[model samples]
Structure formats: C-alpha cells, structure tokens
Target chain A: MRAVDARVRALESILVEKGYVDPAALDEIIETYQHRVGPRNGAHVVARAWTDPAYAERLAADATAAVAELGYGGRGGEHLAAVFNSAREHHLVVCTLCSCYPWPVLGLPPVWYKSPAYRSRAVLEPRAVLAEFGTVLDDDVAVRVHDSTSELRYLVVPQRPAGTDDWPADALAAIVSRDSMIGTRLVSV
Target chain B: MFDEPWQASAFALAVALQDRGVLDRRDFAVALGGELESGHDYWDAWLAALEQLLAEHGLTNPGSLDERTAAWRRAAAATPHGSPVTLDADPQRLRHP
Candidate 1:
C-alpha cells in the first residue's frame, strides 16, 4: 500500500512538473480531500436500504443505530442519518466548513466534494452544482440543502430509478455511484 | 496513501489548486515534504499544515480550529447511500424520523 502511494505521489509530482496542475491548485486539492471525504461505511447502509424498506426507515430516522443493526458501523459513521430525495423535493448535501461524510458505507468522497468550488458554492448555489453533475431539478421540485456538521452526519437515500424495478438488490447496487449517494447525480438507467 | 480513486482525485485537487494560485507553492512544497517524511497521507499532512498556517497567520481566529474541523466533518457526513441518491430520511426506526 505504501509503495503504491509513493508511486502515485511521484506520478502526481511528474504531472505538476509537466504543467498539468499549478502549485496553488495542488494545495487546494489537498485541503479539499483530507478535510472533505470521510469513510465508506455509508455504501453498505445504502445498499441495505434499497433492498429492505424497513431498514431504510430505520436508517433515515437514526443512522447510527441503523448502521449498527447491519453490523457496519465505525469511523465517521459514529453518528449517521439518512435523507431521502424524491421527485417533488430534490436534496443536495455539502459541508460548507469542511467535508464530513458517512465513510463507512460511501467509501471516500469525490474530489469535487472537497474543492472550494464545492464547499463554498454548495451552500450558496446547490442547483448549479447539481447541474454540473447533470442533475436537472424541475421548477416545481424544491431543492433543499443539508449541511453536514460534526454532531450530526447526513446521507441522501435516493429513490430507486424507474427501469431498475426489475433489478434485485445486488444488481441494483452496481449502478449506484458515490456521486448518486452524495445526491449530486441520480443513478443512470 | 489512498487506495481509492477518490483519494487520488483528492490529491489531484491539491495539485490543481496550486496550479490555480490559491496557495503558495513554496509553502505547500515544504509542508508536503514534511508530511511525506512523517508517514502522513499527502492530504492529511497538507490539511494539518493549512490549519496551522491559518492559525499562525491569523487568517482564522485562535482556538477555533475545532470549529473549522467540525465544519469539515459535517461535509463528509452529508453524503448519501443507496441508488439514485435521493435525500429523504433514514430507513431505520431507531431514531426519530
């Protein structure tokens, strides 16, 4: 693992030397990640929710307990909660101060989630950010922004896509990307 | 050293930020070198240094590191799980819905 990390770092340095990323931009990116993405524990929880509605309700109400029930709770998932997104009310989440996430299930957060563009703009302009991810909210749909804080963490439980009705829970999991779990994009059918 | 793509992408963001002039190259390089030596992941070390710099330079008020850290924590907590990524409530009955 360490060797791979070093190689990757070396490669990144090479890219920077080659003028791929400016010096300052690199700092911002670093700031975004260490401070943004949390754990991947959220993924298992999400998968469970999709397969079991009863569990989904439990997760939505009390994330920590719900996760513990599934025996997949730890790290950033110490305190967890689920937020549901639907056609009427679209929800987007961001950590305006930093990147706090349900890592036990979701793995790591995407780079954009940690960027100043994402952190600062997510609260100020959620619709725009979602649009960048190709999520177009209807005018009638109200966009709600949830800011993740230290005391309470949030997860978006997106509604299952239309054509995916026939897919079993395991098959459905394949199409669920981290971005979709973050509420930035919906599962592509 | 992140084994995941998101981890690598996070490093990419730092590089991109340096390229964009949001951070000073010399200071960042110094911090990165120190972090690599201490076995800290690239991003972890950079954030620690940034936090320190912010405090040392009075960019943020003293004794507010906790607040800043908490804010970052919140962002990470807000990610969604499951398919289609909708933001509603949890699926469990353990907590108040």
Candidate 2:
C-alpha cells in the first residue's frame, strides 16, 4: 500500500512537472464545480421538501433513502442526511477533519467549508462565523454546530422564508443558495 | 502549463481520489507514468483508467461498488452531530406566531 501510494505521488509530481495542470487553475475548477453544483442541488432538495411534506418527513428520517426516491442517489449521495432548520433552533455545518460533503446532494463542498478557519472556528465560535456570512440569529435562538466526518455528511434545510407562498417549487428553489443550506445565510424574502 | 486543460484536471482528480481513498495509489502511479500532453487531460484519462482498473480487478461485480459506496454514505448519515431541529422541542424555536 505504501509503495503504491508513493508511486501515485511520484506520478502526480511528474504531471505537475510536465505542466499538464497549473496548480492554481485546478483549484479554480474545483471551486467552480463546488459552487455551481452545491447550491443547485440544495435548491432542488429544498424545493422538493417545500412541495411535498411526505418527502420532507422522509428526508428528516433518512436522507439517503429519500434522495434515492428522487433518483438522485448516486456518486457522492450514497450517504445523505438532512438537518431541518426551524425558527427556534438554528443549525450550522462544518467539516473539521476534512471536507466530507454530500456531493450527490450538494455537488461539491465549497473551499471555505474545508478551510481551517471554518473548521476550527465554526465549532468554537459558530455565531461569529454565521455573523460574518450575514446570518444573524436572535439572542434567544440557540445555535447548534454540526461537524461533518468522513462517514457522515449534513445539509441544513432552512426555514421557509415569508412571501414565497404563491411561488411554485421550482421558483422557490431558486433562492435556496448554498450558503443558506450551510447555515451561513438565510433564504431571502 | 501543458497545452490541454483536461490533463491537468486528470492529475488533480487522481490526487484528489487518492487522497479520498477512492482509488489505489499503486495503480494511479502506474497509469500516470505512461504519459500525456498536459494536466488538463489528466482528470478525464485518470477516470477512464480508474474505471478500467475497477473492471480489471473484478471490483465491478454485481453492484458491489454501489454497495460499498452505499455503506460509506450510511456511515456519513449516521453521524450524530447533525439532527433536525423541531420547533416544539427547541427553546429558541422562532415564535413568530
């Protein structure tokens, strides 16, 4: 195993040396994939939850099963779970150990999700981080921080914003940004 | 630096997959050594190589891969840190009503 790992590393070095990738460009691609895909998936899931109470129940009970029901259970979605956010209690998600995410549901996790600042500070001072993201919880609201591990991943289901009453599920989904699902931002009115 | 962007992506994917323990390091090293024009092409090629490796090693048998990935997902879902917040149970539950 060690020998194999070494070889893989060496080959990667060669690829870098050969100029196949600019370390920076690769970073950008990964970032784009994360941003574009993550929020879209979150919006879809949020829309489904809003339109179908039964689906929301299933998602809360078992995310993976519920997602599979939608035919979105492949690739990074093998292990999916949802943490529904309500008015009284708020939930925030962070990956402290590594960037373990529900890629199937949210595509890729944003770079900030995996940063040391996010991982460390999210658990230690979640309110501050959320504040930075422009999410302000009332003093009475208790903030709960969830740390994602390699095996378990999480997505926040934001409380349905007001004035979205007549909108169709698809329309409602448009406002469910990735940041909102991460507990960093709230769904706009 | 290489002309093709895919090659670089391929290299990045290889490293990412290896880091994630999705592919065997030995095979990745062997396949990568064979050569390509640029880093951009690396990701596409690496994925093809990985799929081939999976088939060659008989790792593609009868939903086994899906089952393994499912297990990984289950493990991730079972994590206790994140749970749904119920309005009634939460002391801070928003009382807009």
Candidate 3:
C-alpha cells in the first residue's frame, strides 16, 4: 500500500470511530469502484463505437444513453458526452474547477488529474500536456478541450489505429488506455 | 485511480456523508475550496474537508483530532515501509478516547 493510503486509512478509522462515518456504507462504495467498475467499461464503449458505425452515431448523439445501452451507467457519470477524434480534430477532457471525472467509466480520477498544475494547464496548454503523455498531434488537427463538471463529463472516442480495421472489438479495446479515453494520449497498436 | 483501499474509503466516506445529509455538499465544497486555494494536495484537501465537517458537526474537536493525527503519524513512522501501520494494540480504547 502507498504511504498516503495508510494515512488516509488512519484518518478514516478515526472518523468511523467518532460516528462521523458509516463503515459499512463506506466499504460498499469503495468495493464497488475498486472491484466492480473501471476503465474496461469505457473501453467496451470505445470498442463498440469503433466496430459499429450506427452505434458510434448514437453515442455521439447521446453519450449517456448510448453508454447505458452497453449496461454501464451509475453515479459520478449521470450526464455523459462523447467526442470523436478524427484526422482533422482531436478532443481532450479536463475539469478546471475540481476533479469532476466520469468515475463509472474511468474508475477513480488519477493523481495527476487532481493536481493544480494539470487542472490549470489542461485548459491553458493542452498540447504541452498531450506531448508529455507522448501524443504528438499534427498541426493540421484542431484540438478541442471539454471542461467536466459534477453534472456533465466527457469521454474521448479515439480514432481507430491503422491496420486494425478487421480487428475484433475486444482486440481494439485491449489497446485503449485510460488516458486515451481521457484524450491525454492515443490508442496505438 | 486510488492506490489502495483506504484512499477509496476516504473518498467514499465523504460522499456517503453528503448523501446521508450529515453535511451539505455545497458546504463541503466550500471547505474544500479553502484547502485548494491554500495549495494543498487533492487528497489533503479532502482530508481537511472531512476534518472540518467532523468539527462542524461536533463529532470531534480540534485538540483530539490533532492528537490523534500526531499519534497516527508517529505510529506510521515507526513501522517498516510497506507494512501496515497498526495503531494501539487495543483499538477500542482509542475509539472511545
């Protein structure tokens, strides 16, 4: 376990002992995210979109409903939106106010997403942030930044890589990194 | 993503409290805002919000909180790295104290 995790646990134990927290309810929520939900849910959506043009259209039209069609919808992602990436355009997601992430799809927000530098820089210098993640987009591709909130969040539908047209949905999903879905990185072969 | 069980626990506990109406979400956000503005880390801000809410509800006082946090830190310091930092052998005493 991480050092920070230990400190957090110590604090939680104290809070529970003081009757400020309910241990069972806390455990239920933790176990749900830790074991049941994660990025795989997002990957499945991406893979389906990559394989089915109709589904992709539906996803673009209504992300929350489309995602729920695949049986993945819950708290932290009630209102969802999907932005498709193409040769001419790229999409990136950020939460400038706070760490408002699509938890059902992305699991928990990463440490960097919650950092002050990332929150501010993602809006001011998205290209630089993407570069640090090794995603070098061409000058021709226009980058669109989407700001997430407690009510609305975004998911990036990355362009399908070359040589994967015949690949199955599962194969495509295997290459979809969590960062790719977040638009900070690309899905590579 | 959370690195361990407690990190998620800490996060979930805050959410649960708000859902239970123990504290208002907006109020917690206001407290968290102060931490963020003060340049604290995200989880640190979360911890601060939790502490602030507990105090506001009269669940725990600042003195006891400080003492408990210091004790926890000392216990963690003495433990080997990567090992579980258990507090006092009798947790019940600490619980009631």
Candidate 4:
C-alpha cells in the first residue's frame, strides 16, 4: 500500500507540476467525499422521512427525485430507490455484479461490500450475513435483498425503532447507522 | 470502491487525467482491457494503464515512474500499519530515512 501511495503521489505531483491537474481541486474533491458528503446525507433523508409522512410517501414514490430534493445526487446514485423495512420485512442492498453503491447517500462502499464473498452471500444467505453483522431478525420477518446495478441503486429505510416517536428529526438522524440504511443492521432508540 | 488512501489517489489521478484530456478514455479502456487480460491485480492493471497512457501522452517516462515506485516501497516498508505514510521529497532521504 505504501508503495502504491508513493507511486500515486509521485504521479500526482508530476501531473500537478505539468499543469495537467490542479492539486487544490484534487484536495477539494477528496475532502468532499471524506468529510462533507457521506452517510450523513442518508441520515438526514431518513430522519426527514420519519418525521414527515408526506415526504416519506414521496420518497417511496420517487426516491431519485426525493433524495435530489434534499440536494444529494451524483455518480453511483443517478437512479435512487428507497425500500422501507417494516416489522414483517427486512431490506438489504448488495451489488452482485460489482460495488454499485449510492455514493451520494451512503458514501463509498465498504471493503466487505466489494468482496466476492459478500456480493455472493448477501443474496444467497442474507440471514447468515446479517447474523454476522449481529443483526438476527425474527423468523417470521422476511428478508428482502435488493441488488444494486450500475443503472439504479437501493437505499433501505429501516423502520423507526420503538420509543422514539417524540424524538426530533435531528435526534433520530443521530442513531441511524450506515449499516441500518444498508439493511445489515437495524436502528435502535 | 477503494480500500486504502493510495487506491483512492490512483483512481482520482486517472479520472483527473482523463478529465483534463491528458489521457483519452477510449485508449485507456483498451489499455485497461489489455492489462486485465495480463492477469495482474485490479489496481495493478489500473496503474499499468495509467503508466502506459502517460507514456503515450509524453507526460512521464517509465524510469521516473520506477524511481517513484521504489521510493514509495521504502516509505511503505518503514511506516507501520495504520500509520499515515509520507514520502520525502529528497530521493536520498526517501531511500535511507
């Protein structure tokens, strides 16, 4: 990794020096993904949905437009779809073909999400995979795995946990984990 | 899609190059395909494609790329896992420090 880092940095420096690339722009882009843009965007969306039933209805009807309404859209998230997780059903998202994740909402896909084992098993034995993430569901709860393709991506809106009905959207957003949005885990109050 | 900082950098550099018209996407795709057929790791193929594109574009030479690769190898070897890796500007310090 160090070797690769050194080589990449060298290439970057050369490109920047030659006017082929802008170092500041590069830094800004990296900073955007590293800090500014990420799962927090999805949290806000989820929080809004929990607080506003009308917005939730709109999100369910057109995830792309609703998410864009919140100002989140870009590569890997051009076509966004939201799937609600209820007590009787659990939702999970995976990219069997490749790591076709929704970057605008979920940030970059994790290493496991890109691994062959995860891509295959996420659809094959979702229960077992969820169990590994410490999310064992009720036997009666149906596990619905959504596969993300290059054209469309899925975001799982976990059912609001019990005892948080009065909580504000900001407070609700605080407890929504990336895994919960991915459906590997559930949100808790 | 990337696991490490270097991977992200490599990816970004490629995109930057293509965006700047320094590297042609169609040519890059062909090179990438060839690299993939060569059976190297994914990023390795990416690096190979980038290097080849740079050569075709007269941006940098293989010798310089090799020198930088060696310098980075030393830096990586010296740095501990989970620690940030920094490359020294001076080649001598990069080799010995």
If scored against the real structure, what TM-score would every candidate get? 0.56, 0.59, 0.80, 0.73
- Local distance difference test, candidate 2: 0.63
Residue lDDT tens for model 1, A69-186: 8676654566777888887977788865555666556655666775657877888888888899898888898888887764456788777788766677767766677787788988
Give lDDT tens digits, candidate 4, residues B1-97: 5657777677677767766767775576567656756665667777888888899878898787777667666666777888866665344663454
Q: Candidates 2 and 4: which is better by TM-score?
A: 4
When sorted by lDDT, best at the front, the candidate numbers are 3, 4, 2, 1
- DockQ of each candidate, alpha-carbon based: 0.08, 0.03, 0.39, 0.31
Q: State residue A180's C-alpha deviation in candidate 1, in Å.
A: 0.7
Q: Is candidate 2 or candidate 3 better by TM-score?
A: 3
The docking category that best describes candidate 4 is acceptable
Q: DockQ score of candidate 2?
A: 0.03
lDDT of each: 0.60, 0.63, 0.82, 0.81
- Over the stretch A1-189, how does candidate 2's per-residue lDDT look in tens digits? 122232333344333444533556557555545444456767888889988899999999999888777666554555766998887889998866545567766776665775557867999999999989888899988898887654567888998988888899989989898888888888887
Assess candidate 3 and give its TM-score to the true structure. 0.80
* Per-residue lDDT over A37-104 for candidate 3, one digit per residue giving the tens place of the 0 to 100 score: 88999999999999999999999999999999999887777899999999999999987776778887
Candidate 3 lDDT, B24-86, residue by residue in tens: 765776677667778887777887877787788887677776556566666666678887676
Count of backbone collisions in candidate 2: 25
Model 1 is docked with a DockQ of 0.08
Cα deviation of B76, candidate 4, in Å: 12
Query: Could you tally the backbone clashes for each prediction?
Result: 73, 25, 1, 0
Residue B76 lDDT (model 2): 37
Fraction of native contacts (fnat) of each candidate: 0.16, 0.03, 0.37, 0.42
